[model samples]
Target: MTAASRPVALITGATRGIGRAIASELARTHHVIIGGRSRAAVDAVVAELGDASAFVADLAELSSIADRAAMLPELDVLVHSAGLIGPHEPIAEVNVDDLLQVFTVNVAAVHELTRITLPGLRARSGSVITINSGSGFTSHPNSSVYSASKFALRAWSDALRDEERAHGVRVTSIHPGRVATDMQQELRAMEGGEYREDDYLTPAAVAQAVRLAVETPRGGNIDELQIRPQ
Candidate 1:
């Protein structure tokens, strides 16, 4: 609660990629919590980010994520970095299961996590930051499912920002273009061709965006911020 004690920052999907980078950035300033669906990955991150603990919570399973948040240490910031970017599948032609799976993680899970963390967040006037996608704003044909899931995430985040303002809990969403991550690699594979990793944003840069959003004076809240690959 005071400057002497480090504020706690909980990050999901923090084994590798953006999640891992965010954990590193936050660790420099706050005590960190590394979390993900993979126990191995989370443990690895915990090792690298000392003074941090690990947890296994799959975002796709909303109840499991909610449970983790309920048991989290007093947190000053919660970063929702876990996500899904499946292969391109046309809307009407897309697999039903895939569509629901994306929403289950990217949308519903965030809401549940927030609800579970609400009390602590309100008490400390903490913040919730969600890792979003530019596709949430601009549409790409084959990306309908993924984009729609993120669009819903952005909407929920906006609503939460307004709703939690009275409680001093700020909600911020960072919409970034493709980042050079394993998720991006998986996405590229769907094209059945090699893709230029240099064309995408780096995980470190995206993590920097998050650090900036969280470290500023609590007086001003960035309801939404977008970062793109240049």
Candidate 2:
């Protein structure tokens, strides 16, 4: 297919980890646009994927997100992969600021970006995928803050799928369990556990799950997928 004919995909947090893998996978079939906080990092990924481009901005900033998203004339696929996981503490120890930072990046940004891109997605009968976590379905002892954000994300994705069904826009939430990324390593250290790559799922595996959801035939939608390490 020509450049104009190929599907367009914009993946956030694509400079590293699962987002990077997803970008690489979609670059095979879509004109992947790498989104990240660092211009250099986004540019690097764009170079890595010869057919890809860049969308650099801090997702926590709604105005920047609006400005960046407006540049796109149309989008076929939008993958929300950027997230923040932190303040692993009990409710008593957690503060509103911690909730604010986590929720801003994980929930609010996804909501904002999707809101701005709905027109493009509707125009193209596109798909939206949110890289959620198993924590979304269940809350752990000290990770309630992160879990809360993921839970909210899951709820939003569900509503989005329903709201956009008539517009021919598919929404999917992929809940992964402990992927072997830098974030997982940090989470392990925080939990006082040894970080073992062998025990965790690979980013490529998660990417494959995303590919499956986006590639599903148009007559159907993969509303939610939960992937865990075997």
Candidate 3:
């Protein structure tokens, strides 16, 4: 198919990890656009995938998200892979900075980007995918801020799916257990925990799950996907 005939896929925090893997998978079948905070990383990924490009985006900064979104064209898929891990503490004793940053990226970013992208997606009957976590589904210790943001994201995705069903924009949220990526490592280190790599999932595996949701046949959708490492 020509450029216009191929579907457009946009992914955030795609400089590395699950986002990177997902971009590679989609680039095989669609025109992929990756959003990240690093210019060199974005250019590098774009070099590998001829049909893929990148936009400098910082989910923690709404202005950056807006600037990046303004330069992007309409996309058939929007994957929210950006997230933040907050300070390790109990619900009542959490750090305010951690809470603010986590909520800004995880919940607010999702809300703003979707609000802007929904119209374009609806016009094409596209798809919106958000990366969630198992923590959002159940309670966890020392991660109250992170869990809260994801919980908000989960609820937002559900409402988004319901509202856009008639417009043909399918909204999906994915919940995956510990993944063997830098995000996992950073969060574990922040929590003062050492998780076995063998017990964690790989970024590629999660990317496959995302691809399945995006590539589903017409008139059907994978509303929610929860992947656990066993």
lDDT of 3 by residue, 1-230 (tens): 12346888889988898898888888899888878888899989999888887777778889877766766677799999988877778878976887999999999988888888777898888999999999888868887888888889999999999999999999889999989998888887877799678889988899999989988998999999999997
Compared with the true structure, all predictions reach lDDT values of 0.86, 0.92, 0.87
The residue pairs found clashing in candidate 2 are none
Clashing pairs in 1: none
lDDT of 1 by residue, 2-70 (tens): 222688888988888998899999999888888888888888888877778876888887778766666
For residues 81-102, could you state the per-residue lDDT of candidate 2 as single tens digits? 9999979889999999978999
TM-score for each predicted model, relative to the true structure: 0.94, 0.97, 0.94
Clashes of 1: 0
Global Cα lDDT for candidate 3 = 0.87
Candidate 3: pairs in clash: none
List RMSD in Å for every model shown.
Answer: 2.3, 1.8, 2.1
TM-score (C-alpha, index-matched) for candidate 2: 0.97
